[model samples]
Target: MDYYNGHEDFLDRIEKLNAIGIALSSQRNAPALLEMILQGAKSILNADGGTLYLASEDKQHLIFEIIINDSLEIMMGGTTGVSIPFDPLPLYDREGKPNNNMVAAYAAINHKTINIPDAYVAEGFDFSGTRAFDRKTGYRSQSFITVPMQNHESELIGVLQLINAKDPRTGAIIPFSEQSRSLAESLASQAAIALSNNRLIQEFRQLFESFIELMAEAIDVKSPYNGKHCRRVPDLTMMIAEAVCKANYGIFKDFSMTEEELYELKIAGLLHDCGKVTTPVHVIDKATKLQTIFDRIHLIDTRFEVLKRDAEIEFLNQKLAALESGNPQNVPSLEAKFQQKIQQLNSDRTFLQKCNIGGEFMRDDLKERVLQIAKYEWVDTEGKLSPFLNENEVYNLNISRGTLTPEERQIINDHIVVTINMLTKLPYPKNLRRVPEYAGGHHERMDGKGYPKGLTREQMSVPARMMGIADIFEALSSDDRPYKDAKTLTECLQILGKMKQENHIDPDLFDLFVNEKVYLRYAEKYLHEYQIDQVDLTKIPGYTPPAV
Candidate 1:
């Protein structure tokens, strides 16, 4: 019967060890995994306390990772929020000798397990620190089992030390049995493998994320006016996404996002404008209607100078002819005519200069005047008569809206299509499969009037809609854009509200943006001080204040 009972106890320990192995293999979080490994080992051996130490990168010292003592009610590290204040245990002495005096160090250095019946009577090992700890707490220190955790490569990764094994029946301190030591060694081996795998996975993820951020940085560096745009958009996107998740009384009240899903959305935000790299710098930074490689208005100014010189020369010749004909009376009228012509030339020069600049609105009369100017004849450097403005110049200067000509505007808008194509070519993992959709949908409108795909509100995802808002708001409030000044909070909100009314953006999000004051929060972090102004909710078009 005693033999059978011993057999049963051995089988029970085997089951527990098997259970611990499974748990260690499946655990993903590093801190929690380390804690579980230590706790599992302690439970199998009925140890009063245990400490897990991970080897430092240089392999010169063992750093405390998790420490737990049930009898002393002490827990540090490994998700405990309390830190281990003790210094790391050195693996080698000053002379490069293995520190075998320390049991944990000895196990790590020799890659072997050391089982001590009683630490106080143990030979050739230092217990001074352990003794000191016991003295302060008035607790007895006995029986120790130290195991070296070696990975598949046969390299020591860490050390696991259990103290004061207890007798199950008497609850008295006892030495660890051979079976307990064997089980602990097995557990430590499994834990070492799990830890190595976890670290490898974490390093790979870090590399991937770093690569993504590098690409975003590359795009941002290409345009000085887009300072931190790729970085800030993701911040704003996540801010709105989180706000929507927390909201309980809107269309997004039931919406939610998992950690992986949130990461996917963030990646989309960072890569949204990546295709802008393919856009021409001239088009992207065109600050005026006459801007190309250089502002052509300067060239037009030179032509105006030529015309004025011709007028002055013609007047002088006419006066000379009149005087030669013995008629001095016509000289004053000729001088007056020359002065009037000079003044008209100056007035035309001023008008063209104003036309060269871009504005929010270009009236039809100004466009017609630009057309008329295009018809004026001028002598070219080659002594040939040419129109004051070329066909291309007329087209550019006559643009009735922003600086971009229709062709250039189309080129700028093609970036979204390029973005979609580029993202679609990437073989994204399951969690990030919607990257193309979210990144590409930012340009789409709620009324299906948007570009690339023209996805309406009904077809678009909440994250895509959120990104649209983020993109518009960031562009509106940014002081770095070459084309426009940073608009104040009131101006940006009013424009966004008008967009909401026109079905250019998500209406529900617009309401939340006003009610929750997301604009204010974003402004505080990223907007220029002057851009942040008093926003009047009542005056903002299409925005109704949420019920108090």
Candidate 2:
């Protein structure tokens, strides 16, 4: 009221408007931004009430977004946690004519600002709803200004309707001046652009998330076994991270993750195994030592059949010759020798089959048996004798752990290296700059003995260490792996505890993981019912429960 003794100063309002514009442009959240826009517009004019309506996506209606009634102390939508009970106002009738009867719609449809000094006497717009509201609430509705919110291209984004401009000097209701209308129009323009930019950013985020999902789908199609690992690891990662966040007694008691930081961890978890896409599916899905495009144990079985057939042929030939030479008594010994050879061959074949099966560890004795079995000779198709097990078959059959040879294991480990290489080149936002670090560091060990970068515990972030534990736990308890049986919860925690003792994983994190029972939390969600067996904390190696 400094300018006209009863009105707001024009210069001060302009400066305030510029500041509000800056604030609007910087806000990233949609609801907060919409709420800011309405509040900013009202503050400039000291308006008593306002209700912002946005054009619906279908363009057939105006949807209420933020509603405020200062005298009644009623606020809804935006960030208020209160919802508007009103439905969207139709922009057109069922017969497809412009709905000019509604004041907000008229301003939006005509791209004109409607300035009513008093709504009770305003013409050409419906005030029946306003009258009904006033009658119900016993409050007078007066002094309206409806401004069309449009972008630089003059496309209507929404309508900003201010109610009852108050005299700064006396607090009496006054008509919105021409200056007020102009300022409101300019503010709506700025707010629209801000909203548009935020929406564009949101859409891009959605597209990026969708791309991640598509990558997951590709992995599923590439190898379903690994696909399950891909999904469950993230879940388990978050479970541990959250437990750390809520820790009340460990080294992690002071640790916490903001929403943005947790979101970064989550994205990293989702992308941790993304480079597995480049891994060969055969090597990734190798279920048995002698497995290639198919299991080679069957080939060994056929060779055993040929060896038995040869032994039978030789026995029959010798027996017939003995009978021809009038030594029929030799037939029983020949038959006994043949039967013994057949039994030995059957036993050797059975042993080789067991050796072909994969497990966590292969015994030295079993490996030596494979080597001795490899020395057995068989007739080749060209009539030349050849060793029963070729060099490659012997190597595959003698895999010391799981189904993969050292070379195949290296090929599998290269996936983490590939993940690092791929993510290092990605252009994540500043807030998510640590995604590559978190995702690629999962395979690293506390003692710098793990693969790729081999980050030590102190050299890595807590989240990366957390990811390592999650990766191990998920692999341990997961039944979907091609090489190992689904381990019980106790078994999984026992391995983690040993890893901690050996400096393969962070000790503090392992303690927290055990004390908090992050493994059981994960097991309940991802493990099979049988895998969720009784867990005894006292027996977990290198792990001690926190004192109560």
Candidate 3:
């Protein structure tokens, strides 16, 4: 007997179908959407079992997405997470003929609905596997309505198959009525459209992320010393941001980021250094102060060689003049003086070599010595005497800190301004409107003493502040930087804490960063074993233990 009456039940199922259709349209997740569609169709017809198979990307086969057999207490796939162990059904035979022997495949190929009174007696279709399943489970396979799911464009997306429609009053299995089958077909059409839309969205999202990562790789690759700084910074930024959200006891305990905000921050992290794309390769790759297209230290090296040669030439000339004047004793004195000059020149050359490395602070004494070396005269290849170190070379060797001169440092800092200009001009979605603000503010100091806009802590967003910390920590901890030695875990935290105290970084983020151990997580992944020396939190400048 039929369960659905052509009147009241039909109208009620129609209402459910409408509600399910609306719900299906709003679903963004793919698995949940398929579950809803299958569950919705089952609820409408009171189905005891069902299966949903979507066409593969190549459309050569129908892949098993979900299967449910309520009578046998079996529920698999979708939200239940139980995978269907069955192999995908092929859509064509070896001879290239359509596979009409399987009901689901036949529905997909023909774009038609299949209504069967009983699987055991079904004609022109193979029920051997169905009977085998029934025997193994001690169950009866009967009364199936398989509908091909197609979008509004009339493209087949999948097949929605239902089994054992039960009479509602007596719980007896019955054939699907014409009206029930019609409603099932309608539900399948809605489901197909929803699935198609989600796939399109997922593909677009994947494409956007891939493009962002590619650009980040390009920026990082531009500088050999900073190898993966662009990649590592974003990862550390997210780790810090997530720690803030999960912090049970902290200044940011009440703060939270939505999914959209998290994604926007992630995008901002990946693109924070996008402006580096416009930065000069020479400036970015400046491993030493004397480095331009090549290290100018080599030129200074040639000049040092000339100075040594000039000393030897003077010694030989003096020796020859002394001998010619019949005073060989004067030649001995001249030779000793020449040896002292050679030793002094050797010492000065070594000192200049150390200064050119640009690793440690260039003290006032060191700068004066570099200028004094510039006063030494050496004969050029053209036989003209010139200062061993030129004005520009002296200035470079006298740099107070890491590789860059003031003008080049300004050029490096200007990348943030360029980043802001580039991102601000684009039409970002409303959710991501703050990308430029977040990326641009990474260079700004908490006390308004830093770059471009000089934004103080209160003027910046939390994510921007988080980015600043991440950027600094990555640079400090990186092993490949030519300007500095590889910093240990303790050293990194010490510098970060000192920066926090100096108002160079956000205080709350610093506290959360140190106390929550986000730095440890990052170091474990990116830093070398030698750089992972035991960190003493108590000794770190701004680190305070969480209140008990």
Candidate 4:
């Protein structure tokens, strides 16, 4: 009967240890996990009070973490509250002369469980001057059980201490039993393993977030106009994506993306313009219709002024000759003609600036004038004018559209190639390895008319197409550029819709975007009052369709 009873008691102890381990594992955060440890130790050992302490990195001290008690009494004169120390409590020297709480420290140092029956009356125990705490509270410190929480590698993580263990039936403070001490040790071991795993996961998440932040900042710093583009796109894209995700109802039944994946997508959206780092800043923020570095239009205006002054000089000389010959009447009409020519030149300069702002849309007639200005030859310091452009000189002069002069187009287009090259150099993990594939294809078209590789719709992934649209949308909606005002949402969508009709962008995504009112969500999140407010969507012709 005694043998059978002992086996059953051993099984009961195992069950309690497993239950406590399961409870400890359920906690996600550090505080809750520590609280579980304290409660489980109190319950397992039938202790009056228990305190869990975390070890400092140096392993020379105990840092009190959590304390559990049934009914705690406050002292009259004690200033420090019953809370654990805000800092680590240092261990004592070699002598056992009632120094600091060496029992807790010893457990952590040795990575072992220590049990002291009747701590106040134990042999070699000296409580001469340190008995003030017990005298004040009228509570005698008795049995103490300290167990080291060690990870799988036997590295000490922390210590757990149980004080004044009680007998459940008699309600009297009893010494900790051998079985209870064993159970506490086993529980501490399991808790340490679970905590180590949590720490590793949290560390990895922080590292990933840090990398994303650094990459976003680097991409923004690439160009002045692109400075705020990376920050705003993620804020806008996430709002739109989350709203659509919520509205899908049953459409997202099979879609099992977590908050983390969505966050990664937002990070990817912010980094979509990282390829622009390879693109020249001057090209990215090109202001004029025929602009590369310095605008020649101002130089052309100076030339026009010189031509008018020369004409005036010629007219004044003729007037002087006519007056000397007694024919001053001929001077009036000649002066009038000179003034008319000057007025015409001023009007033409105004027209060009307006034309430059209007250059967002392609027009054959305006484009011809733009090309004419781009082709104009400027005399170098040698007084020699050059016509044919070398590849390097193209970006040094005027361009008709976008950033690239005809010769610079290939160089600008190679940004995607650079993006592919740079990203492929890193051995990215499986999940993020496709970043290059997505970011590199942002400038590609669906009709095989894009630059570099000129990939068609059949070859592109949905993510690549999404990024392309996001890049364009952010560029259009952004007001950070000094060259052009932000395009109105109505105007932006209409342009994208036209691009879809021309087979340049994906038509399906366009429909999905408009029908779901995706741009409004984006505007609400990232756009300022100037970008979104007081705008009439109806004034935009193709933006608002007929009611039917």
Reference-based lDDT, each prediction:
0.90, 0.88, 0.89, 0.66
- What digit string (tens of lDDT, one per residue) describes model 1 on residues 451-480? 888889999999999999999999999888
Candidate closer to the true structure by lDDT (higher is better), 1 or 4: 1
Clashing pairs in 3: none
How close to the true structure is residue 23 of candidate 2, measured as C-alpha lDDT?
95
Candidate 2 wrongly placed segments (more than 4 Å): 1-8, 322-328
Query: What would the per-residue lDDT of candidate 4 be over residues 50-75, giving only the tens digit for each residue?
Result: 77787777766677777655646421
- The TM-scores, one per candidate, come to 0.93, 0.94, 0.96, 0.69
The list of candidate 4 runs beyond 4 A from truth reads: 1-99, 102-144, 150-157, 161-197, 355-358, 367-403, 406-413, 437-466, 496-521, 534-548
Model 1 residue 326 distance off true place after TM-score fit, in angstroms: 5.2
| Candidate 2, 41-70: lDDT as tens digits | 999978999999999988789999999989
Number of clashes in model 3? 0
Candidate 4: worst-modelled 10 consecutive residues by lDDT: 73-82
lDDT for model 2 comes to 0.88
Question: Which consecutive 10 residues in model 1 have the weakest lDDT in total?
Answer: 1-10
Model 1 Cα RMSD, 1 decimal: 2.5
Runs of candidate 3 with Cα error greater than 4 angstroms are 1-3
Kindly list the per-residue Cα lDDT of model 3 for residues 116-160, writing each as its tens digit: 989888898998999998888899999999999887778779999
